[model samples]
Target: MKNARLATATVLTAVLATGVMADAGAQPTSLMDGVYTAEQAATGKALFEQNCSTCHNADYYKTVLQTWRGQPLMYLFEQVMSAMPADKPGALMDTEYEDVFAYVLQIVGFPAGETRLQYAGGSMEDIAIQPAP
Candidate 1:
């Protein structure tokens, strides 16, 4: 019985280690560093209240970040831009999206970067949203 338990534990440990190793090589986690500005985030907050607050609330961050943990920022961005507002899809301006995302990051306690985050067309796929710090 003792030997069987030890074998099972050793297998579980190896499996866990392998999983971690695979994640290490996967796309790097994105950081908030220099991604957006305090000013942008502030503006984003206003936009959020006016345009987004109706459908989304404080819990929005938890839901979104948790769902898109390992996905690219662009994936999240596209989802927001494509089918948001419920009343109208793709209604907001591109900058508005950025601003809204900045606001989201701000509310989630992500530190603002020096410059405002610009829309990255292709590179967004490369930028993974890291788990909130």
Candidate 2:
């Protein structure tokens, strides 16, 4: 009985450890993980220049990104979606806004990734806005 109990405890510990590691691997800890693609960033750049450049620039974003460090990227996305272009807030499609965000990330020196950034299903919330490394 003693040997059986020890085996059971060891198995349980392994299961728990696997679960914890899986959870940790499932979520991204920072933007430097290459969350957006180069193509997406390019699209974002055009959109930003056409819609957001007159009011905001790379320097402006440097300050804003600093203040937003350690926060989720979603918060900034929502802010831009609701209060951008200095005239038409939420005027662009959701994907367009995401593309614009990718541009911002590129300008701020985040590495582009194979995957494009997405706002749906809490992915953005999972990605934290970290300072350029």
Candidate 3:
């Protein structure tokens, strides 16, 4: 009976440890990390001007970032993708949307990184929207 209790305790410990290790492996990355490329941001700037400038500008994104603070970037991406441009929604290619998002991040004081932002398969969900430090 004592050995049975000991074995159950060992199994529980192993299970808990495995859960912790898995969570650590999948930890979310912060938006403050260099996650988008400068070139991508530049392209995004042009796209924003061409498509989104009439309704929104770089300054507008400050409020947006604040509202989205602590949320996954995927939420913002989806929100914009679904209802942007006022007249036409979901009009741009997915990559174009990503580029526009990258541009917004740049204007809002986030540093551009070597990697381009990705949204497919919920990849953007892993990126947390953090306030500028």
lDDT of 2 at 87: 95
Number of clashes recorded per candidate: 1, 0, 0
- Candidate lDDT scores, in order, read 0.75, 0.81, 0.81
lDDT tens readout by residue for model 3, 60-104: 788777766656678789998999867899999999999998988
Give me the runs in candidate 1 sitting further than 4 Å from their true place: 1-29
* Runs of candidate 3 exceeding 4 Å displacement: 1-25
RMSD versus native structure for model 1:
6.6
Q: For residues 1-133, could you state the per-residue lDDT of candidate 2 as single tens digits?
A: 9999999987886676446435545554578888999999999988988999988788788889777665667878898888886699888999999899889889988899988899887677667676665
Instruction: Locate the minimum summed-lDDT window of 10 residues in model 1.
Output: 20-29
TM-scores for candidates 1 onward, in order:
0.72, 0.77, 0.77
Over 18-99, each residue of candidate 1 has an lDDT whose tens digit, in order, gives 4643655654436565577889988888888888889878676777786666566776888989988768889999889899
Worst 10 residues of 3 by lDDT: 16-25
Which lDDT value does model 3 have at 84?
84
For model 3, what is the error of residue 91's alpha carbon versus the real structure, in angstroms, after optimal superposition?
A: 1.0
> Which has the better TM-score: candidate 1, or candidate 3?
3
User: What pairs collide in candidate 2?
Assistant: none
